[model samples]
Target: MNLTSVDELFETDASREDKQREKVLDIPLSKISDFPNHPFKVKADEAMLEMADSVKQYGILVPGLVRTKADGGYEMVAGHRRKKASEIAGKESMPCIVRELNDDEAIVAMVDSNLQRESILPSEKALAYKMKLEAMKRQAGRPSKEDNYSQLGNNFSTKTSSDELAVQTGESKNQIFRYIRLTELIPPILEMVDEKQIAFNPAVEISYLTENEQTELLETMKQEENTPSLSQAQRLKKFSQEGRLSTDVIYSILTEEKPNQKEKFNIRRDRIDQYFPKNYNEKQKEDLIVQLLESWYKKRQREQER
Candidate 1:
């Protein structure tokens, strides 16, 4: 990983002092404003509330980045969520760290900061990974014929650059590919994956399903009234291979609205036991045996259905 593309990698030839000055700093949030052109932040109502709650207790732990505005003020380069949360917390101003980031550095720094936090969600992580790849792309430009988005799938985007980036970053090509696959997952499904309700491999497999098919599966999960289980996913895959799996069929699998339990009691005592050896009567034994037989019959029927 010769990330040290020499000149390309550094963007500037500077000493330790310059690097130290470029490190994240804490400035008043009031000094920073939104980037009208920034594309990394997703507008998530739930996420906004989550961020607000985090700020209310801990305060802004990681300072935001800002570039000097043309209007003689600071405009946010990253940490929009933090900035928004500061407003929600009723703070008169928030802390910021100032910097001059060329487009690639700003994008990478923004993502790098968020990625360091312990509590980012799966969707957010997906976006973070995408941002990194794109930023790296911008810095390195596109690869040669290897840049096909299809054959490489998540393994490489704009194929021209993944191997080089992986070498530079010391991240494996496989991991990069997996992170990329996560982007294909729809929002609700991604939420499930984030929440740990869905395992990764199955989630990846589910992601392979068309977007419409994934939507259908989500609806089925609601109706079937059960969380999507590992077994159910395998069954869905089987049907998909058979070409009979549809949103409707998946819904039926989920709802599985059939009778749950029907039990019966039984006995296999010797015929001589009917005598009860004393006061037990013929009618009592006869009734007990009949009940036992009915229970056994029902059990057999249930077994046959399975």
Candidate 2:
């Protein structure tokens, strides 16, 4: 109401507007580079298509975060999916918040930003945890307690880097290490874990097998048409540690069926994938196969009756 009060209100409004303007910028997609070894995937799946459609109609409501690179342009710290969606939406540029961040800070920010997604593959979480844990250790300048790689089975104290990550991410320190161990698995085995062909617990135990032994196990699995259960995998690990594991030993262990283990028919995905549409997921392909099989069986029954 007074002259002084009016001037103060006007100054506050001007400062707020200036701050808002400084926070977001319309950055070109070409000028932005994805983060190095970004663990999160930006696939053109159903959700991504929906996001692209939304971006097309409404524009990018939430701005991406990036930091300036030394060479030139900007490095994306978050919002990789947004970038891809914008591209699909025929957008040349999207809103972003530019900031100054060191390598460690960038790594932490990237992991934190992506971890909240509803669906994350086991491999993605494994690599992301390893990267973020290493960055957290570096940021501290000295190892607190996680340096004891062999003793990860033991309960970690509050002073450890893993403990801090556990608190921040709501994953137990033991579970975090379990996920991190997955990084040591061979790509084929890791892919199996991602596809849900291998259970998570058994896969973690299998990670302890040496590369050669793992190769042997994979071959044995193919020959037997069965995968190792958790108990079988633990026995393999024990044999490997005792220095007695061999191709024969792996075959022997894998062949001994567990209680209630029934015979299973296995088919390599690549062999059948050619018959299905590109967008068909595993369930859809399976349903179609069952439908075809039922039709063939009914036709055979009619012919036999004749």
Best by lDDT: 2
Residue 140 local lDDT, model 2: 87
User: Cα lDDT of all candidates, in order?
Assistant: 0.67, 0.89
Across 1-306, the per-residue lDDT of candidate 1 in tens digits comes to 645667556565566457667655555666776665453454548878898888888888877777777667777877787788878877766667778777678767767766665676666665666666777777876543343323244443344566765675566666566666677878888888888877776676566667778888877665433555556666776787687888678877765533452343334346457546566675786787678889999999999999
- The C-alpha local distance difference test score for the whole of candidate 2 amounts to 0.89
Query: Judged by lDDT against the true structure, how good is candidate 1?
Result: 0.67
What TM-score, to 2 decimals, does candidate 2 have?
A: 0.81
Q: What TM-score would each prediction reach against the true structure?
A: 0.56, 0.81
* lDDT (Cα, tens digit) per residue for candidate 2, span 1-306: 645676566677768687656478899999999999998888999999999999999999999999999999999999999999999999999999998899999999999999989999999999999999999999988664555433155664547787788899998777888998898899899989998989998998889899998998988876666798899998999999999999999999988869997776778777887999999976798899999999999999999999
What does the lDDT read for residue 209 in candidate 1? Answer: 65
- What clash count does candidate 2 reach? 0
